[model samples]
Structures are given as C-alpha cells and as structure tokens.
Target: MSRHRQRQRERGQAAVEYAGVIALLLFVALAAIQLGVAAYAAQQAGTAARAGARAASMPDGDGQAGLAADAAVSSWLTPKTQSGSCGDQITVSVTIDIPQVLPIFDFGSARRSVTMPCD
Candidate 1:
C-alpha cells in the first residue's frame, strides 16, 4: 500500500512538470509568429512605397499615389502614403501599422520610401 501511494504522488508531480513545459513552448511559438508578422509588414511597406512612386512618376497619368499604395498591400495592412516632388524626381513614403499577434507586444508601425525620376 505504501509503495502504491508513493508511485501515485510521483505521477502527479510529473504531470505538473509537463504542463509547465508545454506552456513555455507555446509562448515561444507565439513570439516566433509575431516576429514573422513584423517582417511581412516591413516588406509590404516597401512594396507600397515603390508602387506609389512609380505611379506618381508617370507623366500621362493622374496622381493617385494613395490608390496605388493601397492596391499594393494586404487589405488588413492598409498603407498611408505621402508624395512630394523634388526637382525632376518624385518621392513616395508609405507607413503601415504592424499586426499584433499578442496584445502585449504593440511594436508600432513600419515605414518605407522610394524616389523615381518623373517621366
């Protein structure tokens, strides 16, 4: 009877240890996923900047920098854009709010800029 009780107590301790390990692994996986989301947001911002600048540089097209930028990225990662002319060149800047995987990690936003000569 004494040996059986000791074995049961050890099994309970082992179960608790496994639960703690699984929780830790889950947190690490979540952090990795959040980092990937940040990288994707940065890449999207760059794409939006290039597309907007290309559109802005067209001599025959009406200026629609915002429209081009919005079409270049995911719908959830909508980009805010600003365009200006410096001499013969046009520059477009794009900013996007990074998606949150965990509420505690609000890493703000990503931004990118591109310049292209006017056609």
Candidate 2:
C-alpha cells in the first residue's frame, strides 16, 4: 500500500512540472507571433514611404503623395503619412500602429522615411 501511494505522489509531481513547461512554451509562441507582426508593420512602413517619395519626385506627378502612401499599405495598418519638400528633394514619412497579439501590451508604432530628388 505504501509503494502505491508513493507512485501516486510522483505522478502528481510530474503532472505539475508538465503544466509549467507547457505554459512557458505557450508564452514563447505568443511572443514569437507578436514579433512577426511588428516586423511586418515596419516593412510596410518602409514600402509606403518609398512609394510616396518616388511619386512626389516625378515632375508630372500630382501632389497626392500622402494618399499614395496610405494606399500602398494594408488597410488594417492605418498608415499616417506626410510629405514635404526640402530644397530640391522630396521627403515622405510613414507611421503605422503595430498590431497587438496580446491586448495587455502596447507594442507602439513603426515609422519609416524616404527621400528622393525632385525632377
């Protein structure tokens, strides 16, 4: 009877350890997914900035660089874009909110800028 009781206690201890390991692995997986989302947001910001700058630099292009930037990115990103001229160059900047996988954390925004010479 004592041997059987000892085995039952060991089984309970093993179950608790397994639970802890599974929880840790779950947290790591969620963090990895959040990181991927942040990276994708940053890449989108860069792409939008470059596209806006390129459009603004063209001689015949209409002054819709801001609109171009917004259109270049996914709708869910909600890119806030601005364009300005510095000397003979046009600069475009894009800011986008990074999507949060976990609601309790704020991952902040991803921003990017690009400059191109005016034509």
Best by lDDT: 1
Worst 10 residues of 1 by lDDT: 58-67
Scanning candidate 2 in windows of ten residues, the lowest lDDT window is 59-68
Model 1 whole-model lDDT (C-alpha atoms): 0.89
Candidate 1 off by > 4 Å: none
After superposition, which runs of candidate 2 have C-alpha atoms over 4 Å from their true positions?
A: 60-62, 85-87
- The alpha-carbon lDDT assigned to residue 63 of candidate 2 equals 71
**Each model's RMSD to truth, in Å?**
1.8, 2.2
Please report the candidate that would top TM-score against the real structure: 1
What would the per-residue lDDT of candidate 1 be over residues 1-119, giving only the tens digit for each residue? 69989897787787899999999999999999999999999999999999999988887534678889999999888899999864588889999999899898887999999989888
